[model samples]
Target: MWSVPVLPFKQLISSALFCALSGLAQAGSDLRADDSRLKSLETTDAGRDWEAVGRLDRLGEGFCTGALIAPDLVLTAAHCLYDRDTLEQIDATSIEFLAGWRNGRASAYRSVKRAVLHPSYVYDGTLSATRVRNDIALLQLQRPIRNTTVTPFETDVRPRKGARVGVVSYAQDRSEAPSLQEVCTVMARQDGVLVMSCDVDFGSSGAPVFSFEGERPRIVSVVSAKARVEGNPVSLGASLADELALLEAQLTGTHVGSQLPHGVSRVQVGEPRRRDMGAKFISN
Candidate 1:
């Protein structure tokens, strides 16, 4: 029951025309920012409990949202470990995780020693549901963080379509501190990718999607991109249950050493992805 906001006549006309041309199906309206629920953690009470969700700093160049899954393991989008302009893999040593970051301080900080992506993940300049499904990466920390305040999250199964979910992300405008969308919905599940009705932006890539099922929260997906499908602003994510297991198995073997199968050096020329659909495929 969300209505489009009143806009100037020209803007409204242009919007209508754009929707028509895009062939977007008119479904539910996009999510609205209440500020009360999705407000900045820097000035909110919810910030006190979200210590495990941290910022993945890529050598001061940029950042992406990440969360700790183990004492020495951090989870994020595979694309975040590469440079967008050059498409080159950023050295794992150059990345750091700032847990519970707020006002230029962090409860725990650990540098990355290695990173592993899904073996099937290849950046072939194509954007598809399968690509997003395998867009996960695991960062091995140089040192383990054994703090009570920064407990790692547990992984869980993917939620069904129309299920209620939540997201914690550090976006472009709110990069200083993370924000929590306590209420978002899974719009659809195409192939292995999830299209969610959550609000995300540039730095929101790799943000953790959570499900409040039991006593503790469990991670279900990793944010990959934001898009406008049939006029509805939706966020894309990859289910983590299978992806995490594969990455863990890769890390357990020597595949992560000299014979890294998911190394970022792999790329190929192919159909360029569509960027005009509000898809911000950013490293952040």
Candidate 2:
């Protein structure tokens, strides 16, 4: 029951197409000169009705995207897991995370309790541009989100070279319905990782990646990749607090920010996501 379509981001844009390919993959001059504190993107409509904690499944039938960051996690990509060498498990008992989701209804459907896939995913099928190098994944909810736009996971600001990113998914089809556009910018940043101009297609893959701590919008990056810069397609990514400092050193303490690594159990988030986040929210 998540409905909120207003449309009009250049009519869902398909013209900017990654800013008409003004460039591509170029950052390594030794790298590491981009620090932070440049700010200048303040978004309105309360961060655009801000509420995207992702999930919706289907793929072979339809849909695929994700968000949510701790308070029950939810940060998708690792090829959305599942096809793990055919271990298959997509519709894990009705998964959902539609915070502010459109055309589908869920303004807050929170369920999902699994979906890991990032120990170096190998789906033996084809989505492996080199395991997409830990294309990132996580969706652990059983319930813990206090909400306020469910935004966590910052990876502590890194990606630079223009900085001023944006992107809040629910893409569906570039127009005619399903609102939410999110003005973008960043443009480039390789090593620290970034290539924005925010605007994606087809469910807008694991979309997240906002920038505005001065205004209070978190999430550092996601949206795996969707090339065509020269031919006109966009979206490609990495940099969620700079890969959460290597996933907080392999999720030590589980918060990727610290506090879980004691007995290492406490994972259980909800009970539907299907990759396993159930059993261990504090059981050891």
Candidate 3:
């Protein structure tokens, strides 16, 4: 019973299709990201079990695609910590996460030290569907990678309409490394947004979206933005069951910024879009 679709980031990117040429394997049948289903963890046994999937850099503003549900959190995409056009909110030690990056070396970098966003994520630029079902975010890592090859990710349940989901991004012509389409699907489940087909771009905003049923690979949504819908090219998420337990109790409470209880507003929906706007909003 979830079919809410407000949709309008200037009419869904004024006629969508922009994730550096997103086709998402043509949405429903060949879950494609070609090259054998989008694999490219940049070798070394293909990123050795995805070393907690990372790359969230922000220092100069430009990057997204995170994952690592613990050992210093991480999870991403609350508009990638804002600042689209002075909506501002960027200072968490300038953010950074790297972890297993590849070729540009990273296996663990850490920096940001505290962050949270899911109190009904009110970024009000009107890209409704409650802003991609409250595009999530979490950070918090100045240290604590406890490496063993980075393992950390676990948050299932939220895959339904056509299930079979998977994605691991870091896009914009494959920035450095991180790509694992692994057969996408989940083609619709509105109101908590999740119209995926996987394969995202623009640094694949907070990428994660996994859901491999039993034995590992859990996550359940994160990407957030890259819609086209009726014309295909989906991808837009935000459904960690109940906003990841209220963002893990506001990331272990103590009333975060503005005294918590739902207080962290940011708005920057379709800023100067049309640079091939396919409903892109992965922030930064």
Candidate 4:
């Protein structure tokens, strides 16, 4: 088990918008015994099938995980576009998507042309259900990746509690290539957030959480934050169905604020108190 400090219930309550507090209290034991270990996709053959899942590199800064949803559209976490120190939005041109990067090589490389964040998303540096729910963003690539091996993934509705899911992510320790956690349990789904028994860490933000219920896996959520529930580590993600549609609409100029320059509009919600709920944004 991951060694993480326990978060006080009061602090968790303060941070949560509509989380199932009762379910979270008992989440530690909800993980299934069959959950698979993280397997490194380091070799070309091993990572070939996941070419669409790539590293979103912020020029001089660090990187976050992202996945291609269309020929030119990349989905990722909204916070990945903000400077952690200054909390300022980063330039789209400075961002690059390194697809299927492994062992000093990549299958395809593309620069970001434009980016859009959920209008309601705020970068106040707090861990809240509100933030997690609105954490998704879409990046328009300067050039579409048309490689045969780099097919984009499709999005799907969120999974139910106890449903088996998987995650493909790059983290601080596993930065060169992505790792696949083929099996994890959705411990709880409250309001619009999913509390899952998936392992994630810095640089895993925006990593795609996939559901394999159908013939092919489809994206169900994006890694938002890593937290401890009942002294056990868990990853948090937003239910994608509605939020992803909103993001797509924003990208297609259908949403009200879609015409904004840089395609980003910021709304200020009352900032929640900054408390360490044993929660950390999974972005490097």
Candidate 5:
């Protein structure tokens, strides 16, 4: 996570509720809003399913959903590649990507060939994600995935006001489950960002938000942040297409870092810890 965490948007809502509902028990449970759902591999491609996206380090071991973005690129949250407390980079060698994981099957397990976090991700402490700022990462697999079940590489076109979109990811809190569901709508686009009614919780960070641009699904943004008032997930456009073109020319986007406050890193954190408790964020 940057000076900010990729996930403080919902934390604010949780915090607000933690303070206000400390006394009401179940009566106060719904005081705050929540993320709708993240899409899942199984739901999108029934022929194939996610095994598990695993990474290990001196810090510990964890998992997340890994979706194919390109022949060699996998998209996930930037925080998954860095340390939350230290703001230090994680050893890529210690990282592993597991796909098609389920019922004791490797489905797909590959080492991270390379990882590229969003350059503009802000580390500042501000967490207004109605239109998210920081929440994206790209990982290249050692070997290209070749299977029909695998989702194809795609990114969103400029969103329309009521375009249909949803999320899919392996969320936390469900130790032995990966339920991918569709329940989000593109609410608006402000400042070149896409807003959605999609709900997100821990483990939902970096999940791809899809919109039907034409015949195929186009990814518009990634799950970046959330809100207490709107009860929807804020997604930021993934600048990979334009960013990669820029990086090739020796450049990066200035939106995130340029707008961030001091004392923050360029990386943004979005995925949640294994222990967090919420309505299994972003179905899928």
Candidate 6:
């Protein structure tokens, strides 16, 4: 198993964490019991429906899972764009989005031209409700994909606690092909962070969390970290509705902030972090 950082359960119950998560709670029906298992989307037939989800490769360093939100826009975790070692931002030119990547090939390949992180996001190699609540990023491709098979997904509001959700991602063990967990429940929602019973691991960062409530699956959140809540493993993500709007504004120069920096940063691969006060964030 990958040696990941562990946050104490007591810390989560404290006021510091709870204050960071204060927000209005939505009411939704409880999730029905279902067999939650990871199904490999290795075959073309089985993976056709999820063509927009792909691997965000940092060249020789490591990769994180991302999904297309528009013809030239990709959504992922903000931490994925920061180097774990130096806490520096990665260059957009060095990152590539392998849309519908399976086996040894991809449906469409595009280099990232720009990346915008949530303005409130800070990468200090720590985990907190504030960081997780803003742990989202948007990437602009050098060129539009415009592929028939690679249709972008629609974004939606955050799911209520106990709602059923799904995740498709590539991990350390399943690096070549992505796997789908079709039935994970939102265990809790605090402030703007979501804690779900989704199965994720290293390299699963930035993976899209889909809500199947409408006619089609819509992205509700992006996997930020995997944590053990009171001994049960859970995945953490930021509610996309508000955060996504801010990112889009920033990308279009409508938001009041500095433009995204241009430079190169490396990804941290298979590095064990010191067990401290934060959850096991997957930044590889």
All candidates' lDDT scores? 0.71, 0.48, 0.68, 0.76, 0.47, 0.76
Indicate the TM-score of model 3: 0.32
lDDT per residue for candidate 1 within 126-218, as digits (tens), equals 455556778999998998898988888887777776678889988777778899888888766545566677878878889999888858878
Q: Write the per-residue lDDT of candidate 2 for residues 9-92, one digit (tens) a residue.
A: 223223332232233323221221342322211233433445554545543344456765656666766555453345465654
For residues 132-187, could you state the per-residue lDDT of candidate 3 as single tens digits?
67788778788879888888877766776677877888776777888898767765
Model 1 TM-score, all chains together: 0.78
Model 1 misplaced stretches (Cα beyond 4 Å): 1-25, 28-37, 229-231, 254-284
Residues forming the 10-long window of minimal summed lDDT in candidate 2: 275-284
Q: TM-score for each prediction?
A: 0.78, 0.28, 0.32, 0.82, 0.63, 0.80
Question: Which regions of candidate 3 fall more than 4 Å away from where they truly are?
Answer: 1-36, 44-96, 102-108, 121-132, 138-177, 182-192, 199-236, 239-284
- Candidate that scores best on lDDT: 4
Model 2: residues with Cα > 4 Å off, grouped in runs: 1-23, 27-73, 87-140, 145-161, 164-185, 188-208, 220-235, 238-284
Q: Is candidate 3 or candidate 5 better by TM-score?
A: 5
TM-score of 5: 0.63
Cα RMSD, model 4: 7.9
Model 2 — TM-score against the truth?
Answer: 0.28
Q: Quote the positional error of residue 21 for candidate 5 in Å.
A: 21
Model 4 misplaced stretches (Cα beyond 4 Å):
1-25, 255-284
Arranged by TM-score, best first: 4, 6, 1, 5, 3, 2
Better of 2 and 6 by TM-score: 6
- Candidate 5 residues 203-275, lDDT tens each? 5566666655557655556666544443323433333334433222221234432543353223322222122
Error of 6 at 131 (Å): 0.2
CA error at residue 73 for candidate 1, angstroms: 0.5
Each prediction's RMSD to truth: 9.7, 19.6, 15.8, 7.9, 10.8, 9.0
Candidate scoring better on TM-score of 2 and 4: 4
lDDT of 4 by residue, 103-214 (tens): 7788899999999998889887566777777888999999889899998888777777789999999988888889999999887665567778898888898999998988
